[model samples]
Target: MTRAAELPGAASLVLASGVVHLDPAPAVFAAMLDGWAMQQRTRFLKASTIQSRTDLVRRFAAYTNEYPWQWRPVEVEAFIDHLRSGQRPIVVSTARGYQNTLRLFMEYVTDVRYAWPRECEEKFGRAPVQILHEWNTVAHVAEYEGDPRRRPLTYDEVQALFDAADGRVEEIRARRRKGALAAMRDAVLLKTVYAYGLRRREAWGLDLTDLRHNPKARQYGRCGAFYVRWGKSSKGSPPKRRTVLTVPEMDWIVPVLEQWLDEIRPGFGPGRLPALWVTERQSRLSRRSVNEAFEAARDAAGLPEELDLHCLRHSYVTHLIEFDYPERFVQDQVGHEYASTTALYTGVSDEYRNRLLQRSLDRHADRWSVS
Candidate 1:
C-alpha cells in the first residue's frame, strides 16, 4: 500500500515515514502555484483588479519566502506588522487585500482537505470587501475632509458630456482630424454607453453584427433583447443571450457609430472583416481600451474622474425604474434569470402607494366642470 504522500501531484518529497521533509519545491510554494494555475482555468481576472490582487500575493511571497504552508497565519500577522511600521493606512489596506486573496487561494487549495486557522477571525475581523472599502474611506478622509464622490453623470450632465465630445466627433465625421487613437476610441465607446445603456462587458463584447441596422441575425426590437454568449455564473456554458434595446433607448448613439463603421470598419474582402470597434493599427478592440475610453470621455465631458462603465447600466436601470416600467419587463430585458435582480429599482414605496391612492381619489372625486 502507498502512503498519500506518494501521490502524483504531491511534492517531490513529503511527510515520508512520518517525518516532514523540507524539499526545495515546498508545499507552500506549490499551493501558491496551484492558486495561479486555478486562475488560468477561469476568466475572473479580466476585470484588471485581479492583477493588483496577484501583485499583493507576489509581495507576500517575497516577504515570507522561507515560511511553511502551516505557518501562513503567523507569516500574515508578521507581514501586517511590517506594513504597519513603514506604510500609511492605504498601504495597510493594500496588504489586507493581499491577505484576503491569500486566504481565498488557501481555501481553494485546501477545500475540505485542510482547515483555515482559527486565529484568522481575531486578526482581521471584517469581510474582505469591507476591509478594502474601509481602507479607501480612511485614505479618502485623510486626503479630504469628507467623502468626495465623482458622482454619476446626471441627465443634464449627460447633455454636457455629449456637448464636450461634439467637437472631436465632428472632426471624425468630416475626416478633417485623425483624433488621437485614444481619444477617437474614447469618443466612440462613451457614445455607445449613453446610447445603448450597455454594460461594460457588453460594450467590450461588441462585434460588427451587434450594431447592424439590418443584422443578418435579424435580432431587432425583440423585447429589446440582444445576444450575449458569455455571462456571469453561466458556469462556462454559452447561452443564446437576448438583451433588450428600445427604439428610443440607443438610437441617439447610432449616428456616431455609423460614422465610425463607415470610416473604420473593414472594406469588402480582408478590409471587410468584422470588428465593431477597433484600433487604427489593429483589427480587434480590447476590453481595456473600451474602459480607458470611458474614463477619457468622462474627463473630456468635464465630469468627475471615476465615473465607470457600470454607471451606464445603472443610469439605464434608473431611467426604466423612474418611468414606472414593470420589474418583470426590466428583468426580462436585462437577461437576469431572477426577477429579484431587477427589484433593485422598486424602492419607491411612497410613490407606489400615493399613485394607488390618487387613482382611488380621482375615481371618487365629484368633477363639476364650470366654464
Candidate 2:
C-alpha cells in the first residue's frame, strides 16, 4: 500500500521509539501517537484511555482495509455517509474520531518529513482533500437536536443502577479475588465514578494519588493540563482540564482504597497510587474494563440494555440540573470544554421540557390541579 504512494519518490517511513522519519518526505520527522503511546509518557491517565484510541484506530483500519490516502476521497465520504445513516449518533462521533486520528497521523508525518508528497500532489492539483458530505447546514443543526426520548433517569433510577452495579462488583470481587480485599475496594470504586459522573475514559484515567484527600495530591480535574505530558500535541485530546472534587463523602471510600493501596497496587504507599483502577489480574485497568464493569452492573441491576456507561454520567449531571445546581458547577464537574457542550447535558434532558410544559395552560389548571 505504501509503495503506491512512494512511486512519486516516497521514502521509508521509519518509527523507532516514536521518532518517525518518512523518507523523501524529510519534513515528516514527528512521531504519531495514539492513546497507547501517550500512556507510556504519563501515569496520569489510566491504561484504558490509550486502549480506547488504539481500539478506535484499529476499528478504522479493519473497516477501511487500507491507509487513508489509499482510498479515494469518495470512498472516505461514503463511509462517513453510511455511518450517519444510522439512528445512533454516537456511532457518528466514533467515526469522526478517525478524522482526528488521521489528522494526528498527517501532523506527525508532516513534521518528520518537513513536507510530504501528498502536499506536493495537492499543490499540483493531483490530489484533493475530501469534503464532508453527510450533513447539510439545516440538517446538521437538526442532527444534534436533542433526542426527545433521552431525558435523564430519575433519582430512584440512578440509585437503583448503582445498587445494581454494587451487586455485580461484589460478585466479581468474590469470584475473582486476584487479591486480598478487592470486593470492599471495588464497591467504592464503582460509586466514586458513577455518583460523581465520570466518562469511561475519566473513570479509568484516575491514579490513586488523584483520589487522595490532600493538597499535594494531583487533581483529577487538571490531569489533562496539569500533567503537561498528558496534554495535547502528543495525546490529541481536548487541551483543557475538568473539575475534580474535595468531597467529604470521599472520606467514605478512603479506607477501602487505602487497603487496596497498601496491599494490591504496584507502587503502593503514602501519596502513591500509580493508577486508580486495576484488573483482577492486578494490571492497569483499561477503558474497556470500566465499560465491561458498568455493563455487568447495569445488566445485573436489570436496567434497560440501552443504559450505556455514559448514561450514568448523563444521569448524574441531569440530576444536578433538575435539582438546580449551578450551570458552571455542572460543567466543571462533567468536564465539558465548551458551554455549548455543557448546554447539551444541562438543557437537552426531557425533564426540563416536561417541566416547562407543565406550566403552560390555564384552562386545565383547575381540572388537573388537586387545589
Worst 10 residues of 2 by lDDT: 224-233
**lDDT (Cα, tens digit) per residue for candidate 2, span 162-218:** 677566556666786543344334455566665666666666676644543335533
Question: After aligning candidate 1 to the native by TM-score, how far in Å is the CA of 362 from where it should be?
Answer: 5.9
lDDT per model vs. reference: 0.53, 0.51
Q: Candidate 1: where is the Cα deviation over 4 Å? A: 1-32, 35-56, 70-100, 108-151, 170-177, 180-186, 211-225, 233-240, 247-249, 254-270, 337-371
Report the error of model 1 at residue 204, Å.
2.2
User: Which residue runs does candidate 2 get wrong by more than 4 Å?
Assistant: 1-139, 142-151, 169-184, 212-239, 246-273, 279-281, 347-371
**Cα miss at 266, model 1 (Å)?**
6.1
Please give the TM-score that candidate 1 achieves against the real structure.
0.62
**Residue-by-residue lDDT tens digits, candidate 1, 1-371:** 55423432232222133444455235435444444444434643443455555566667768877433334455767777777685454354455455667665554334322211221222223111112223322232332231235333567777766666665666666785655444555666676665555666666676666643334324332223235433443533443356545545555555556566565443312365455566665566687877776665567777776566666665666556555677776666566787765554233345556886898888867664454
Best by TM-score: 1
